[model samples]
Target: MNLEELLKSIIHQENELYNLYKLGETFATYELPSMVEHFKWLAGEELRHKRTIESFLEEDTLKGTAVIDYLDSLSLEPYFKDERAEPADLEDLILEALIREKHSYELYDRLSQILSGSLSDIFKMMRQEELKHAYRLKILYEMIGE
Candidate 1:
């Protein structure tokens, strides 16, 4: 779990989140009109995050193997729990998305604490975005009377 490995894992997790939000968008398109744009925006944000993480791989600063232990100890399972095959309940989806956003925020916050310089800055920004997503999800939940 070198820097490249860590970054690839982050990119993969971001892709999973992107898929989750895209599913949310699809479900919202048919069931919750007011939430359609919000889901789309979230999916777009995840894509952007993925691209940013991918960009790190091309940089020469990814030569460290010291972070391997931390990467190995990190659990991305919470962020990967998107039950795509489940029934399309808007409320349930939003709740799950909220949970995922919270987990993402926690992960990014921890990473920002452990890493310094550009990596720290990126994780901090990502953590903020996840917080925004959680806040918006809460508002959406209330708007839908859930």
Candidate 2:
């Protein structure tokens, strides 16, 4: 895959993550105050990721080389495992987010090894951020006793 294709894939994944975070935020709002705040923070992080990917594309640094269809076929199921399972409470939501973040981190970390230049750095940074988010969610889950 070329740089442009890789960047586009990254952007697409970021958008997906943003949507999930929004859903999580909605779920969190109906729960305890602490959870509401935690989900909101996660949503903000997703937005930041979206902006970063957009900025990278806008710089014209990524060259489109690979076919879009082929890249799109890459399955993201592992990152979105709970898309079908409805969360029962704030703790459930936190656990779901933690799982998603961990999957994202693994995916991006693997992708980073194959990519080079700015795209590699971007993926590495995203993976790191996801790890942090996972850690935060884990802590929240423990605090909520679930």
Candidate 3:
């Protein structure tokens, strides 16, 4: 995909993640207090990431950088997964969130491998954030299991 397309896709995926976090937050309300807090934190982080990516896109566009549609092929599998667990299954909710974070990390990591310079740096940063999310979610998941 072209640079602009890729960026748009990334932003969309990030927003989808934020929405998923919101869904998790709603479910958390009836579960553990800690779960509610964690979901909110994750949702906020996702929203922040989405805004960051959008800012980067705007900057790059204004700079007349490589945000064109020149990719030989443009195909990105959807990254957002539905949270299928019921409200009572708080652990399942956490597991689903963890899975989303891991998927996002992998997606950004893959993009970074194909890109260079600023794009690469942005993807790497996003990948790192996803990793952080996954780590926190993993810890929360473990605590809930305990």
Candidate 4:
């Protein structure tokens, strides 16, 4: 509700996302050709997001009111959709990645609307990055599906 509480909640979610991506990279590295680089890159993005979120707590210039329970309405289904899934092929892997990116993108976009000023700008940037990730996954999925 207040700044501290909001930051704690956001930081927790960001850390969860970061860990998920890190786990994804770890699994990707075990593949034959190895998807280490791609997953690693995405994981790095998530790490950056985590750091960015932490900064908001300390950034006085950008400190506006944070929307408490902002993510309460957002479905966690897509983010966890393939958690127990084992990818049968590269296409499957790409589909799972796409789901993750799309969910993150949607969250950022919605949060941006609820945020104001510089914080909104940051969320918008994150949303665009996630969109790019989704596009990349789509291309990979198409290529592997053929």
Candidate 5:
């Protein structure tokens, strides 16, 4: 894909993720009250990601040949995972969110490798944020399971 296409695709994915997290937040509000705030935070983060990717469409630097080459070569298959079922319980909900976060982290990790300079650094930072999200979810899971 070209630079514009890639950015649009990423923005779409981010919006989808934001919806997923929002769903989780809604579910948690009644069934898993302890997790409501966490899900809200995750949803906000996803919205931020969507906006950031959208901003890339206006940046001339992202249209460079090297960036386009990386975009064309990037495999987005793993970035699009299967639709998650409604969680039956708190554990299920947390696991679903954790899995999505891990998937995002892996995608950013690979993007960081293929892109150059500041773009690579941006992905790296996003990857780290994903990792941190996963870690926080894991901790919450352990705490609630106790």
Candidate 6:
């Protein structure tokens, strides 16, 4: 896949994670109130990231090869088999999210360096947001004594 297609696929995977997190929040039977709140907030932030990526695409003035199909095929569930099989404890979940965010940040950062113009800016912003998410997850993990 080309750069645009790869970026779109990343965004699509983020969207899937956003939805999964939302569902996880709804289904979670957290023993601690703070843990419940943390997951809910994380889910919201994931959705916010999804919206940010969508907005960036809308604002992209330069048209490139559209790759909606490739994006549509991506899923986040299979990436975390342990979490998918049995829901992790709050700290474990946060750490898992942090790892995912780190991977995404690295991917986007590499893409940003290779790309130029608005596309580069979009990837940079995405990488920044992923890092922010990772930071938040780390904080939450520490708070939960993980």
Please, what are the lDDT tens digits per residue for candidate 2 over residues 9-82? 66666666666666766766665555766767788888898788788678864445222334455454565343
Worst 10 residues of 4 by lDDT: 76-85
Ranking of all predicted structures according to lDDT, beginning with the best and ending with the worst? 1, 5, 3, 2, 4, 6
What digit string (tens of lDDT, one per residue) describes model 6 on residues 57-123?
6676334423233334344234323233234555555555666676677766765665677777877
Whose TM-score is greatest here?
5
Q: What lDDT would candidate 6 get against the real structure?
A: 0.60
Off by over 4 Å in 6: 2-8, 23-29, 52-86
Clashing pairs in 6: none
Which of the two candidates, 1 or 4, achieves a greater lDDT against the reference? 1
Q: Candidate 1: TM-score?
A: 0.82
Worst-scoring 10-residue span by lDDT in model 3: 66-75
User: How does each model score on TM-score?
Assistant: 0.82, 0.69, 0.73, 0.66, 0.83, 0.64
Q: lDDT of each model, Cα atoms only?
A: 0.77, 0.69, 0.71, 0.66, 0.77, 0.60
Going through the candidates in the order shown, the clash numbers are 0, 0, 0, 0, 0, 0
Model 2 spans > 4 angstroms off: 1-13, 56-60, 64-77, 80-85
Off by over 4 Å in 1: 1-3, 75-77, 80-87
lDDT of 1: 0.77
What local lDDT score does residue 8 receive in model 5, on the 0 to 100 scale? 77
lDDT of 3 by residue, 25-127 (tens): 7766766666778888889999998888798788874234433332343234545333343434667666766777777887778767766787778879989
State in Å the error of residue 143, model 5. 3.9
Lowest lDDT sum, 10 consecutive residues, model 6, at 76-85
